[model samples]
Target chain A: MSIKTSILSSIGQKLLLATSGLIMFLLFLIPHMGGNVLFLFGPDMFNSYAHHLHQLVPIVIGIELLMLTSISVHMIMAFRVVLANRKAADKRHTLKSSKERSLAARLMPVSGIMIFIFIVKHLLDFKFYEKAKTTLHGVETYDVYAMVLSRFQGDPVHLVFYVLFMVAVGFHLSHALQSSIQTYGIYVPREGSKIKLISAVVGWGMAATFAIIPIFAFIK
Target chain B: MSKQINLTLKVWRQNRGEEGKFETYEAKNIDTDASFLEMLDVVNDELTLKGIEPIAFEHDCREGICGCCGSTVNGKTHGSHERTTLCQLHMRHFEDGQNVVIEPFRATAFPVIKDLIVDRSGLDEIIAEGGYVSVKTGNAPEASTTPIKKEMAEAAMDAAECIGCGACVAACPNGSAMLFTSAKVSQYALLPQGHPERAQRVKNMVAKMDELGFGNCSNEYECAVSCPKGIDVKNIARLNREFIKANLGKN
Candidate 1:
């Protein structure tokens, strides 16, 4: 079979999705979290961080390309698998029970879609928006901290949307964390519950920390 | 005398290649000690006595070992109790004057053959693909010669408990057979005898399962819950791991 068809097959699609998701979580998520945390350190720290990131244009572009590719692969594979799963089962159960399935597991696709939208909107607001810049020490750099505060401080709707998206990210990661491990075949039966708990904590923790940044920006 | 309960059964009836509907039947005075299949037999006997066609369901062993008997009772596969097959579920679990709805295991892959009977040969086709060890007969070592760890043995045995029953597919919302296929893969993957052809075995079997119209697993653990053998869903994870490992270097 051709490599493309092989990867499109059931098991292959899942492997690609899980691997890409884990990679994005490691490379993109960690750096994004670090940058957002700089918001709490006040304007100079956050703006200087943005200025430093701007200086490494080539490296930033490389990482951005990789992130785009990873996100595309992950989303495409997920959609194919979900659609195939729906087509495979032609009937629905009249009486259903959720004793085994978690809410996060069931809502993965929904949360994924939300996260996708949030990512695009976030990029538009912070990365591509042509806002006025402030010159610091005779160097013109984008005032990212001011832009963030302006977006949240006076706009309740924007703040709510951001917080809601963060919640969606939390739900998505709760399942994805443990699921990625399973895809890699690292399951220890005795530690199943422990793994699930850890996944939940990490997922919610990342989401909460990110959400707190905007809320803090608005209130401060 | 055993306590007897009368039940109202709404059993699905359909002929080969025909549309089916529910036909209500009254099963009166069934012994609480009777197996679920036996209770169905009692209903069929009454229908026969009334000069009416009896219900058609599949069953060979009254004992639960044979995977022949399966029916969705009250929206639960093999009945409401967990880990109990249709043949082993006792009538005592039901109250008098209760209503039970029975239907065939519904899936695109598992078509209705008759009342409460479905064609599960698709599962057999998956097993036929690569679900066996092909070691030479004379080269087989004595059982004691193979020193398997206790934990691994127990895990293998747990996976081996899968009776090839299609309950996993029936119970799943997506009708995925990943649990059943994964259990088979795990059973052999854990044993040394199955090491030689591990790569081909998982690859061929998974391809066949997908080809046979089984859905992809979306991490819903319903299959494990509905399994009569209580086969763990972790096997599915292991199957994924094996699939990735098998195809690591190849294009």
Candidate 2:
């Protein structure tokens, strides 16, 4: 089959989902997590990082556009795959699911929807919200660090919600990372595989790191 | 003497092209040693004696290898036993007074033919899409000359063990044939005989699978769990690799 038709096929759709998901995981999520780490270093480091990031407008715009495309593709592919699966599994036995199926794997779609909500709320609060003006490293830029603090500070409900959603992120990524590797046809051992362990670590690790900001802000 | 257990079985009943429903039957004095199919046989006999048509499930070769007997029992494909087919599933595994929900493997591609039998011809159609080495090797090459790596052969053999049972489809949330197709692809991809048609095989089989209205695998690994042969998801990874290699070769 040609590339055009191939991409529309069932296996092709999975390949698309895996590719788009990996794009987000690598280009956006990883860097996003790394930048989030700066918040823990106090306002100076965090504000300076944001200020420098704002200076790279062209690169940032380019990444944002790319991320837009990736997220769109990822969402579309997931939607299509889920619909097709629902159709294929038209009738289900009342009794379902082998115990061997992981809860993380089963909750993928649920976690996915939760993450999407988290992203929107996150972007609205941080990306779109106006930050107080600040001079950082001799440049006037948004006080992104302060903005993050204000959002999470003294709001127990907000802190709890943030942490809860991080658990959702953990669930989604734990399965997604390894599943994507397998979809790419890498030989990850089936039983007791180190790749599975690493995937879970990276998944929960990022979630924990991201959650730390809200938690620390709430306490401080 | 083997102990006996009674089970309350809620078996799905339907006519061809008709909507199915659960019809419960009481199976008393079932010997624990009796296979699941034999338990059904006893149930069928009672139904026949009552002047009612028996549960119209399918079975052959009472052994697990025929891939003939399969049903979703308690929501698990092939009765939820790891690496066990329905025919090999014994009554001993069931608890007395337990309620068993038995139904056909449900998938859009796998239409219910009767009570517990589904038309699994879709699997055969997928196999037809190039699950073979069409290019005949003129003669059997010397085993020494072949130099097949033991690991590769073992993997190939593992894949080839797939009996084309529809259990994987039944277990999958998406009803995807990925595991089955991957196994077929891997069986050929790993063997030298399959080298000649390697690229074409993957491309064609994948194309057919898509064309047949099967769902894409979301990497749930449910299929591997339901497979009586214990087929691993690694074959699917191999299939993906083969697909990429095949497409790249064409380009």
Candidate whose DockQ is highest: 2
| Model 2 CAPRI rating | medium
* Predicted structure 1: clash tally: 0
Tell me how each candidate scores on DockQ against the true complex. Answer: 0.53, 0.70
Which runs in model 2 stand beyond 4 Å of their true positions?
A: B137-145
Winner by lDDT: 2
Q: Clashing pairs in model 1?
A: none
lDDT of 2 by residue, A1-220 (tens): 7988778887778888889889888989899898889989999999888877878899999999999998899899899888888898886857477655789988988999999999999888778887799886787878887788889888899999899999999999999998888888897766788998999999999999989989999888
List, residue by residue over B215-241, the lDDT tens digit for candidate 2.
Answer: 888777889889999999989888989
* CAPRI tier of model 1: medium
TM-score (C-alpha) between model 2 and the true structure:
0.95
lDDT score of residue B104 within candidate 2 = 88
Q: Encode model 1's per-residue lDDT on B1-251: one tens digit a residue.
A: 58989999998988989888889999999999999999999999999999989999999977787889988889888998889999999999999999999988888889888877899999999999889998777865777997899999899999999998799998887788999999999999998878888888888898889898888877767888888989987898889888878777421
- Model 1 lDDT, residue A96, Cα: 62
Identify the leading candidate in terms of TM-score.
Answer: 2
TM-score of each: 0.94, 0.95
